[model samples]
Structure formats: C-alpha cells, structure tokens
Target: MEKLYNKYEVYNRWLQDSDGYWQEFIEKTAGYIYWAKKPEKIFEWNPPNPFKWFVGGYTNAGYSAVDYKLGRFGDKTAYIYINPEASVERRITYGELYQLVCRISAALRAFGVKKGDTILVYMPNSIEAVAVLLAAARIGAVSSTVFAGFSPKAVADRIELVEPKIIFTQDYSLRRGRRIALKENIDEALKLSTWRPQAVVVKRALGEEKEPPMERGRDMWLEEFLEMGKHGNCTPEFVESNEPLFVLPTSGTTAKPKPVVHVHGGYQVWIVHGALLVYGLSSDDVIFNTSDIGWIVGQSYIVFAPTIMGTTSILFDGAIDYPKPDLFWEIIEKYKPTLIWTSPTAARMLMRLGVSHARRHDLSSVKRVVTAGEVLNPEVWRWLYEEAFQKNVPVIDHWWQTELGGPAIGYYYALVKDMPVGLEFMEIKPGSAGVPLPGVEVEVVDERGNAVSAGQKGTLVLKRPFPGMTPTLWKDHKRYMAEYWERYEGKLVYYTGDAAYIDDEGYVWFGGRADEVIKIAGHRIGTIEVESALLTHPAVAEAAVVGVPDPIRGEAIAAFVVLKPSWRPTEELRKELIEHVRKTFGPIAVFAGLEFVNMLPKTRSGKIMRRVLKRLWTGEPIGDISTIEDEASVEEIREAISRLKVVKVSE
Candidate 1:
C-alpha cells in the first residue's frame, strides 16, 4: 500500500477533522504488526470521560517488539550495552534477545505470574531489566518500574499500590564508579510494606564485596529463576488490546505519584508510529536514548519503541559526565548512533562543561538530537546547536507528560511514499516544542473550554484521545476522570494543566505549568519565561523560578540560579541578574528575590524540583524527596534562604 499520509497532509487533516484523521491513522499503523484478533472499532468514547482505542484487538507487546522481528532480522543487533568507563561493551542480536525474553517470561510464569498480574521492576538500565519488563508483557502481566535511586519509602508506597506478584531487582547499580546498594533498598522497602512478594535478584556485581544474603523462601537468584523456566515451555500470550501492559508512576514534584496505565495494542501502535515519525528511526538506524528505564521516555524509547522497529538500541548504565565530561560524546563516538534522545537538564549540564569536551570526539555520525523531560531553554538550545553539534544537526525539543505516555507535540520525521530513502526530519524551531504529531489533537483553551486565539496563553488540552494516551490511572478511574476529563466539564478534553500558546505559524510554545505561573500585581507571568530570560545572561548556567507569598502582589517571583564555572555567587552578580531580567523581559520579569546556589534540587530524570524550592522558601513541610539527585542541593538553597533572611534583618 502507498504510504498513508505525508507530514503536511497529516497536519492539515488533523487540523481540519481530528476525529477522522486519528481513526485513519490508527487503522494505517495497525498494518505494521500481527494481531491475533482484529479490533472491532478504532476507538470508543463515552460522553465526557472514558476513552479507549483498538477496542477488540488481541496482540502481544513482547512478541511484536522482540519475537516478530526475528524472522526478518534475527542476526541484526538489538541492543548494545556499554559501561561507564567505555571499557566493556556487549551486543545482543534479535534472536538472542528473543531467547532471553522467553526464558524470563517462563520464569515469571513458573513463579505463578498470570495474565492481569502486576510485577514490579526496581533496577537500573540493564539487559536483565529490559528482559524482565518484556517478559511480563509476554505473559500478559502488567509491569511497573521505580527508579533505582528511589528511597525505601518511595518504593514501598508504589508497591503498596500495585501489590505485585513478584519484584525484580539487581544487587547493586554502578554510578560514577560508586556502587549503590539496590538489593538493600529493596529489602528495606519490603520491611516497610505488609505485602510479601517474591523477589528475583539479578547479580550484576558478583564477587564484589559480600553479596546480601537472600531470604529462604522469599528471594531467588536470577540464574535459579531462569533455570526453573528451562524445564517449562513458554509462549507469548496474545491479549486484548485494552489489557493493561504496564503501570508507570508519575514523577510529580509536589503531589504523591500516581500510577498511569497503558495497554498492549494501543501502546504498541503508538510506540512504533511515534518512534518512526518523531525520532525518525528505521531498522538500519541505531538509537542511544540517554534515559533510565524508570522514566516514561525510557519505558517507551529505550525498551519497546526501538526494539519494535528492529533497530539497535544503546543501553548505557552510567552517568552522563562520570569520570570525564566527555562520557556522552565518547559513547557517541563508540556506538555512532544516528539519533540521540536525552533530557534538557543533561544538555545544560553538558553545556556547563563547555564545548571543548564534545569537540574532542567525532560526532559526524549523529544526525539529530532530541530532548523532552522539561522545557529546553533557548540558551541551552542555541549552545547545543552551535557548540556541541556544530550547527549541522537539528536539535529537536518535544513536549509530553508522564500521563500522555508519548510525544503529543513535536516534529515528526515523516517519510511519505514518494521520498522513502535518506533522512527527512521536520523543521526545528529554536524554542518551541514544534507542531502536534500526526494522530494527536492539541488545543489551547480558556477556562470556559473555548479555543483561544493564536498567541494567547491558555491551558493546553487534548481535544481527542490518541492511541498512546494512557487509558486511566491504575485502579483509580475516578481520580483520572477528575484530574484530566472533568476539568473542562461538558467537553471531552484532556486537560494538560500546562500553560501554553500556539504561535501564528502553528507551533506550540509552553509557558510552564499552569499552577506554577506567578501572578504578581494583577499580571500573570510564566516561571519558564523568567527562567529562560535569566539563562540568557552569560554567567548563569541553570535557573529555577517559583512563586512565594507576597502581601501586596499575592504572589511574587523568586528565582534560584546556578552560575558558570568561573563565576562565584555574590550580591553584585545577583543584582546584575535581576537587572538583566528587567532589561530582557521588562519590569514584570524582575524577580522579587534571586539567590545564587551551587546546584538546584532535581529528580533522577533531571527535572528541577521547583516545588521543593518554593516550600523551602515559605517554610512549608517538604514531602518525600527520595527521587532527588542530591539532598545537599536542597540544603544549599536553604542556606541561601537563610542569608536572605539575615540581609532582611540587617536592612
């Protein structure tokens, strides 16, 4: 069949008739996979709440992602694993990966895992971790992963929610040459929770110091777990389209994290379609997704997306700048990936190391660089294009949330039937998150559910549900309806809770979170706008802005900034930064308070925890911070706030 639609046609159709466009898109992408039973309908939507896709289809995500590619590309490399030091490298071909996934699936089934069962994976990015997730999908079981660095309480809380049949983890994770005890954290978490699930431990570091003792009946070694599966025959379980595939917990900064659920057929379709259209991947390409498997990006791209496309994916289990600032560049030099997807915070962190480190390696193999976790500041975007990638590659910044499950608004690297060979990525706007993807319908609407005019900021909402969008929060359909659907009462819209505006050219621009927008003197300002303006200054490396209570203005803008290598924190520099914001964005952008700190508190995925900063300033109780990268960074901000108080008293 001829390619269904090109980039321009798809966008125009989406704008003209979104419902028709999405139905056709879903039908077209379905041809790429093998289905045990076809769907009865493309989608079914209740009046103002429930939405589902691929209503009656039956498919196995693991079979489609791993086993289906074996006949055509069995010998093709599936995964390329690299260590932090670039010393050890391993590659797993499609056929080999299939066997491993089968063994793991058999093991899970042997341990009494059945369809509809939930399994919790708490490990770093490794072959075992990926196999465990696919194994769960192979058996029609739901899997959820918590970041390896999460605290015992964080893990226990998630475990309490899902109550998985088995929990998979590794003995330890190596970060920056330091060994983090993963199994110990799991043990601690098990103690806190009342549920007793079987623990499957992968000995990643055997004979390195003393290994933790496994409990008699509760814990089993990975090898032994696989051995039990060797005696049993394992086959992929083709499940209904809407069957729960995985439950991913949201990384909300302030509120308790909720589990967002995605299904088999819809999620598989979206991953294959989105990876091809957004990241521009083919079976011949290699992808290096610099995200841990715990985050949504990692769950989608690092594991299922690339593998489903039968492409080589690089799984790096290390820090970006460990041992040397050029670690990422060095990996690129070794692996020569065509597409590199990472977080914006990583880009800023690399920017702080200067371009000299990146220049030392030959990055000619890289065609495109994409970032998504948070908004990409214009300064960092420019630096990435000009300095790091040398103005040759396109730096694509896309936008999506954990709830959406995939890219909702971004450039699509569409290749129509007429032009199938060679790479053809969409145009890249410097700061905007590009246009909506082929099947997604995005709109900026006012409080009354009316579409806002172009260039007017409003709440970002999805007019129609796409295949990749999460069905609902796990076991909490009411919360899902209230949080997303009920907000725009009487209208079937998915409120994103993000303040955004569409430009005259049809590109979507994000203006921070709606709740995070600061209202001062009857004027509303986006925290991202102020943070972006501050980043334009030469000495500033990173900045996080928040709103603090103000008697006169109701809420005032407060900024926390991290300086460049040579610049030191001083009252003069702070004043100059405040003045710089005023000059760049007018008086409204001037911060009521600005503090220079060594580092901003961030999640493991590199998102700045602005809520933590706000709470520290206002003396509010800071909630669970187990996912924070550095607890000391919060202390640094606290000390800066203390100094501000001392200055206030002196004044």
Candidate 2:
C-alpha cells in the first residue's frame, strides 16, 4: 500500500518536464477563463474552486483549438491521412487546416447555417467530417454527429431531437473494398421526417449521380456548396464558456437515447490542458486514435487534444481487424504513431489475436498505449505491457466517462515512472483507479452524505464541478439535477452513478454502477435499455436483463427471455435477435446470445427476478424461489444449459 512512486511529481514537473507542462496549463486557463462573464444565477460553479474551470470565459473554440495552434505551430502537421484504401496518404499542416476551416465556415453560412443553429453530421472519418466539425465550432453553431454505422431509425431519432438546420453526409464511402451507400441511409432516415434539413452531401464515390432528386432546396452536392464560396472570413464567433458546443447522444436506460451536452470553453480547455499532463501527448508525437469522432474518446483525443497540441492524428474509415488482423500494427508501422489511444475492450480483443498479430509488423514507434471505456483488468494490462509493448512502453488505464469529459482518475507516467514491473498504476491498490488529477476533488460517500472510510464501497461522487463536466443534458435541466445534484441537495457534488471504494493507498476501485447498467466490452448499456431492445424483437414475449461476469470486459449482458408461442430458440433465431439488437442500438446492444426460457421468474407485482438470474449465471446458490410465479422456470433454464453444455462457447 506504500506509495509506488513520488505522487507529488504529478502536480510539479519532476518528470518529463521538457515543455513546462503545468506552467503552460496555468497560463492557458488564465488567458481563456476570463474572456466572458456569466450571469450570477446561471453561474452556479465559479473559478477559484477546482471544479469551476472557466467560469466567465468568452472565447471562440476555433481560436483556442485551431488558431492558437496556427499562431504557434504554423507548419506543424495538423492531420495525417491514410486513405480509405490504405494505398494513399497525405498530411495537412496546421496552416492548411485553419484555411479549410475558414472556407468551410463560409460554406456552411452560405448554406443557411447560423450561430445557435444545429448541424447534423452523419459521415465517415474523412477530412470533411473533421473540417465540418471545426467549421461548426468556428461559427458558434452546435453540431451533433451520429456514428456512421447507425441504422436509419436510430439516425432519424437523433435528427428529430435537434431538428438541425443542415445535415452533412457523403454520397458513398469505401470500407475495405466494399462501397457502403452512405447517402442511401441518409435519404431513408429523412425521407418521411416531419422536419427536413438541407443536406450537404459529399460525393465520396464520384461519377454516379445515382441518388434520386434532392427535393429541390433541401439537398445539394458538396462540390456545388464549396463552389458557392471560394473563401471564408476566418472569424471566430466568441461564445460564452457555459454555452453548449455540441450534443452527444448516448444510449439511455430507456429505448430512446439521451443527448449529453458538452459546453464550449470549459470542455475544450479541459482536454487542451489535461492531455498535456495525463497522456503526456506532445506536439512532436504522432497519434493514431482508433475511435471515431462520434464518441467522447475520439472527440477528446483525436480531434480536440491533438489539434490543441498541433500534432498529427491518423483517422481510419474501416474495421481495425479488416483486410488483416494486424492492420493496427501496420498503421503504426506505416505512420510511426508515437501514441496509441484506444479502448480496453479493443486491447482485450487484440490480445486474443495474440502477440503474433502485433509482431507481424514493426511497432518500434509506439511509446505509449492508453485504454479507456472500461477498467483495465490486471491480466489484460500485463498482457498489453509485457506481450505487446514488450514491457518497455507503459499501457495507461484511463478512468473517465462520457459525462466527465476527460480523465478524472488515470495512471500517468509522470508519477509512475520508476515503479516496478506490473506496478504501472502508481497510486494505491492493484485494481484501483488512480488518484484524481492535480486539482479535482473526488470521494466515495455513503447515503448520509458522509465520506465512507477507506475500503468501504459507496457512491462515487465529484465534490466539485471540473472544467470538463457537462453543464446539463440537452433540454433536461431537472433530470440533470436529479441525477447528479439531488443526492447531496445542498452540496456541490455530482453523483457519478458508479459505485467504488478508495483503498488506504488512495486509489479508487470501481464496484460497478449502483443502478442496473451493464457494461459490455466497456460500453455502458442500461439493463433496462437491453430489456427494451429484447422486447422489440418479434419473438420475444418477456425479457429480463442482467450483467454476467467476464474476464476481459467488466461485464457482459445476459438476458432470460421468454418467447411467443411456437417461436423456439434456434441458432437462426439467436442470430436474428443478435442482429436485431445491433441494428436497433448499434454494436454495444448485442452483448450476448439470447437465452430462451419457457417462463421467466417474477414477483407477484410483475417485477422480474433479475437477482435470481444473476445468481444462476454466476453459479451461486439460489436463495428463495417461493416468490417466483413459476418456480420451474429456473429448473428449465438449468436443464437447457445442461443439454447445450456451452460453458466456454465463444459466440
């Protein structure tokens, strides 16, 4: 439990201080925090407090992200591209990206987008997507980007939320060798919608005007729109620090997704400054962030932090395993990416591919590998460090959430530099999430609003708001208060919903959500969300959701579902349900194969006995089945499992 390394080194630049990291961060905050003032009532959290990062800042994100970099590192490469085919590559300097942002900002304005309006982007990881995002930031227009693989209905559901002024997409896209019809999905989503957006379609597959007419004024090709304006004014639309910059919708406990609104000045500044210390990312490093920009990891690492640092970032369009299992290594070898930031779920999957996949290509350039999305299990962590990085490079386990914009607790190299082998996590316990960043305050508290003693599990709460904390969920101020604020009515703490315990060594170990949420492959899926998804399938009569133990992912979704008459569970049906869930709610939804039952155990009040399911799945002794409406339900499930004998079945 003794301190593994000098913890004070995190706050003070005792290690890796080539750039004066902390001093630069303080200066950055000083310049941006006071740019604009907030009304007293609206400004609940203010600076001088660690939680309130940029209280009265009024600055354009464009200035902080792009222009600031342009001023300092004009010739530094802003973006490095690996074409969809991986046959061609290019790099865009900071100066050139700035110019593109200006022209695109003008193009967006010419297309009728304005300040305070919303723009929906459903596109691939091409330059246009990055350009459009920065363009929206330049104009002070809010942008909501839907993941490219989302189903039509899923896209439509998001479209209906913001009712964006314009929608950006591509005509077609190449993933590996297959051409996916991007415009076709957009057309289907918007075809019968009550609200119509002016679609700014980028024609990725040229020479085919294959899509039908664009309903007159509603749709225009990308070439035509760019032609409308040869140049942009390159002006930064200064927005208040508290104003919303983007709305990122995440899958909710319900079937409908919830949009998490991240503000402009604070969230952007959080990454700009925090990345310097936590990830040790620098202007000299080449980063290949494997996540799409639609997710927070991609938003924070690939787009925001790299741009802020004026470094090169590689964005890919297809599967990490496509073409070959070693594509990630190939990219690193080709690009010489100094930083590898991806999810632990991906790391675990790649670990299953074995060290041979990684050894197939040269990876000498990789100095750091960071994993988010889920807690890095020690087994997987050791594999990544020892097998993949050859125990020379550190694989950092980052602990944060979509709600907490960046790292709240993470393993930073600055503090853990000389720690022993397998002791990379510097702070406290073996499985613990490391201590908070320099200024943030965090605690594990019991129901009475008192801090729980070390090793006692309780609610994980942020005692104060950080610069990266979301001001509110989109149009749900009351819900935000109820979710984060109401637990400690008079206190400023935001309840994280996660359950954790801080050990005597000061490291926090997550005990999972206090509520019923299942994390499959590091993605948060509300048990209720998966239950609803199951109900949507035609054969499902009744369903109960629970999280089952997994070695790699923290937990996997397991459902005890009953079927309609004559609809027996077959391999075909299981595959159908899996695909149905995927189509309805993306890949995160399809966590496990459906376990069919003749009946589901429930209380007299119609509540399903999820606890019983959990117990059964974990092979624990069941308590009381007297309350079950049909006591035979458990027996039937056990018998079915016995017949199948699929203890270690992969799928």
Candidate 3:
C-alpha cells in the first residue's frame, strides 16, 4: 500500500488497471474496521445489483464509525453540536457517542426492530437524530432519513415504500427564528401514509419534561426509549457485506422518491479511503461539512467518514442565515476546523450577504474548501476563492450524487501535502470537477453509445460500477436498470444523467443534470412535484416546470402555467402560486418564476421538454424541435420568457 504511493502516476495506473485496483484498497482499509467476519473475497461483480464488495464480510456501519475508533480517539471531540437558532452548543466524545448508540440500539430491539428492518428518521440536524442513524446501523436495521424541511406529503411518500417499524423524530426544530413542529408533521404523515409504523420515538427538543402531545401506546419519549437499553450492554448485529446500512431518498424520473440503498461494507471502505484521498482527513484535523444530515454529503463526510477517521466535525443544526448571515463564519472562528465541505448554493448566498461577515472572523484554520451538489459557476468560484477566502487556500469543486455514496471525482487533496514525487496530482481547474477519485472510471459518451473524444460534450457515464456507488435502488431493481443501465442500447454502462465532458488533461466538467430533476439550493426537486402543485391551483389548467439560473440558489423553479376558462392571469395570481409552492413543498421549493401561457410545449410523444423551457428562460438557442407537437406552443413560451427578461431588466 505504501509502495503504491510512489508516483501519482501509479495511482492513475491503478485506476486504469480497474481490475483489482479497489480490492487492494478495500482489503487494506478493512483492517482498520471492526469486522465480525473478515471477507475471503474482496469483490464480486454481478450486473443490475452490479457489486458485492468485501464479500463474505460481516460488519456494522455504526461500530466502524464509532466503536472502532473509541480506544485511540475516545477523548477527542467527535462532534461539536451547534444550533444557531436555539443558541445552544454542546460537544460529544467518541466514547459517549458509542454509549448513546448502544442505548438506542437496545431500544430499537425493544421496539421490535431487527436486522433487515427499516426505520424512518425524520428529525432536525441534531446529535440525537444522528445517534438514531448510528443506532439503526448498530443493530443492522436500515434507516432512511428525510430532510426535516419536507412536508408531510413528502414524508408519506417515503413511508409508503419503507413501511418502517419505527419513525424517529423530535418535538420541534428551530430555523430562521421559528420553531417548526416536528411531532405534528409526523402525525400528519402517519395520517397520509398507507402503512403505519409501530412506534414513533419523539425527542423533546424543549427539554425532557417539556413534552409534546404524545399518543398513549404508539408514541414514546426518547428518554424512556433510551431507558429501555439503559444498561449500555447491547451487542451489535453484524450484517453481511451487502446488507443495507441506510436508505436515502432521491428524486427519480417520476415524483415518487427513489430509495438509494448503501451497504455497510463497501460504504465504510469507500468513505474511509475517500476521506483521506479527497478531503485529507486526519485525527489531528476538524472537518465541517455544511450539508444537512438527510443528504449523502452529510452522512458520508460529517458523520461516518470523519468520525471513522477519528476526526472532529462541526455538526451544524440550523441554517447559516438564521441569527446572522455570518453564522457560518462565526462557527469557523469559534471551532476551528481544518477542512470544510459545502455546496455552491451556500457559497453564492454568502457572497450576496457581503464579505464583511467573513472578514470579522478567523478563517486561517480552513486549509481547503470543497463544494458540490451542483456546478460552481466560474464567477462564483472566483468570488469564493479570491474575494471570500482571500486567495489563501484552494477552492475546489467535486462531483457526486445521492446515488454515489461518496465523491467520485475530486482533487488528490484540496490542501498541499508532503509526499513523494509520484503522489502529487493535477492542478485545480476553475470550473472542472477535478480528476476521477481512486475508485471510479468516468467517460463521456455520445448519444449513439460511443465514447466521445476529449473536450467533446456528451452524456457523462461510468464505464464500470465502483465501490462508492449505490448497490441498487431499494426494492425497485427494474426501474434502476431501466433508468441507469438501460439508457444506452445494451452497453450496461451506468448513465449519470448529467451533461458533461472530460478535458484533454483528464479533468471533468459538468453542464448540470440532463434530466429534469432540478437542484434548488443544493436540494433535489422533481419537476413533477412543482407541476402537480401548480395544477392543484383552482385557476390553473396545466403547468410545466423547469430550472433556471438563480444567483443565490443554484436554480429556481420556473413554472409556465395555463389558466382555466374563467380565471385570467394576474400579478396577484402569480404571487399566490409562488406562495402555494413554498407552502406545499415546505420551504424547500423556491417558486420564483411564474409565467402565464396558453399552452405548454410538448413533444409528439406527449412528453414535456423541460430542457426546451430551460433554454427559453436562459435565452439559449432553441435547437432542432422537429419532434415538437406544436410550434405555436413554443412561440408562446418564447414570448412569455421575453416578458420575464423585461421584468428582470426593469428590476
């Protein structure tokens, strides 16, 4: 393993080799993990499901993340919990975190959860909720976490699929100086869901005694739940390598949430290796990944990877804009972390808030910056790197998805490191997502399924399945195959659904999602949800939604709506629709673009061309539309967009 670091070229060769490259690292990294049964085979490749890494291995993700590092790093702060809106701060050590997880694991079994059972964790970004995730993992019970910002309809959609034994939540959450009722939302979700959970474990956010309205038998306080396993002597369940550790919801081709299953063995190995290679994780460093606990970035970077590496991480529990726009900077100054990972949406918002907030704080501790979730525009990148960080550190952008459990492409280390000549890698590219990380093989493919030349734009595809990628969509293998593998004719290549290209020098650049799943402020929003919300409006007859460029949010939900017979489009109507989406989607959807149109442009096949709508809104050239059902419909959209441009200029 040491010898492989001789030349950076050697690592590249391993990636090129692709045969046994990952197995070696997987085996080497497994030595650090606490495995109940060591694997005889490093990997096995079977299509559709695609992989079984560390085959024959029996391990627990929570043990690897917490108990494995307890002896060496127990005294160190594993996480610094801060809720800016609540004005509360606390710290937990690895040993303490391990104890808490043990209690939760026992309570889970008391509540009838077992290996292969699933739980829905719909709580705020608190240490308690994070403990629930680890607790589920400790007992080999799969946990599916939902962003607390989502509405009951969103939660019910996931609940119908998961049919979990327990629904983990809290009394309330604080954000933007408001207390959101989490327990109330859970109750509403239970009403909406067809499948009912056995138990709803509620954490009292106010205090232990300040309880909310609890059901007689179904609801229980987290305190009493922990008391069930108060002995702290619970044994962990060692699930097989392919056993799911957690399920994260991502927007698929339709409105239904696609459960992305990530297993314990490969997931643990990938993040451990990735934390070192990509983010330069070390026991001496503190990392701050600003993604919410619901997202993969937060799960991998903030919780599992950093904790498993025996490093401290800042577990932020509120929005950065809450108390002050400088809340992020304030956290950095107070608790100095060495590495920081956030989304470009957050960076763009901070830029709009002014640099004075950052100037007042100490930022020398952040040696490097990593941004993902969406493409970082060159202007925003330069502003963040030059003006914000003051050119003191490298501002790097990496690329991955909810499907990819870890980063697939990023710099060797965003910070400078001392290594032999062979260990050094390429320089930073402003808009590029760096070179491929150690485990993946990425290529650009033309529509005909041929590999494109360097610098040629085409659909980005993975040549082979990697350890970091999701094993399969949860319970929907057919849809997974059709959506990812069946994109091309019979190549079996993994379609990323992103328009991208590789540079001549081997750097990857993304041109956003080729699919209609638009990302607003780093959260994925299916266009179908936006359209459905619009159609529910009394005055709306039909609607089409697309993502358009937004200075602060990476994209805004641009909706083109056709009105009913008696209802005419008015300024008040537009405002009503905007508020409707925000309320319906529970604050995640920013419906900024509302245009009145007679009809929406659709293809002859009856599919809405969201890309065409996006182009018209962005003023990009409308390419060959011969397949369009009606040319007059497109003309109307063009006129609507022109009026929007005029409104923008006037403002």
| Candidate scoring better on TM-score of 1 and 2 | 2
RMSD of each: 11.4, 5.2, 3.2
Best by TM-score: 3
Per-residue CA lDDT of model 1 for 422-535, tens digit only, reads 345556778888888766777899867888998998988987778888878899888777767744556677888777998877788986666556644323455766787688
Residues 1-651, candidate 2: write the lDDT tens digits.
225235455433313441244334535444322243432222244422223334555666666667777666778887877663645567888888888888888887876678889998899787778888888987889999887877776788889887899899987766767676777788888964677888888876545546644657778888787866676454678887767788888765556667888887668767754575567766778888888877778777876767766678887766677778888788888889888988777787788888898877788998888777767777788888888888778777767888878888876554222221112335323355677665456788886778888899898888766668787777776666665564465666777877888787667788666567777766666777678867888899888877777665667777667899968778778778767767665655644435777887788788777767777777888777778887877787666545433632234
Candidate 2 residue pairs in clash (backbone atoms < 3 Å): 35-58, 36-56, 36-58, 51-465
lDDT per residue for candidate 3 within 1-651, as digits (tens), equals 223233356456565565466555555565356778877777687675557787898888898888888889878888899887777889999989988888888888876788999999888777888888998998889999988998887888888888898888888887786778888888888898888775565664565545567888788878887787666546888889889999998876677778899999888877876776777667788888889888898888877888777888888988887788788998899899888889999998888998899999999998888899999888888988898899998888889998988878887873223221125545788888877776677778887878889899899988777777887888887777777774455567788888999887778899988888888888998888778877778998889988788778888777889999999888988888887777657887876567899988899899988878988887788888889999999899999888876664111
Model 3 TM-score relative to the real fold: 0.94
Evaluate candidate 2 by giving its C-alpha RMSD to the native, one decimal.
5.2
The stretch of ten residues in a row with the least summed lDDT in candidate 1 is 1-10
Candidate models: Cα lDDT each: 0.79, 0.71, 0.81
Model 2 whole-model lDDT (C-alpha atoms) = 0.71
The 10-residue segment of model 3 with minimum total lDDT is 414-423
Q: What order do candidates take by TM-score, descending?
A: 3, 2, 1
- Per-candidate TM-score against the hidden true structure: 0.79, 0.86, 0.94
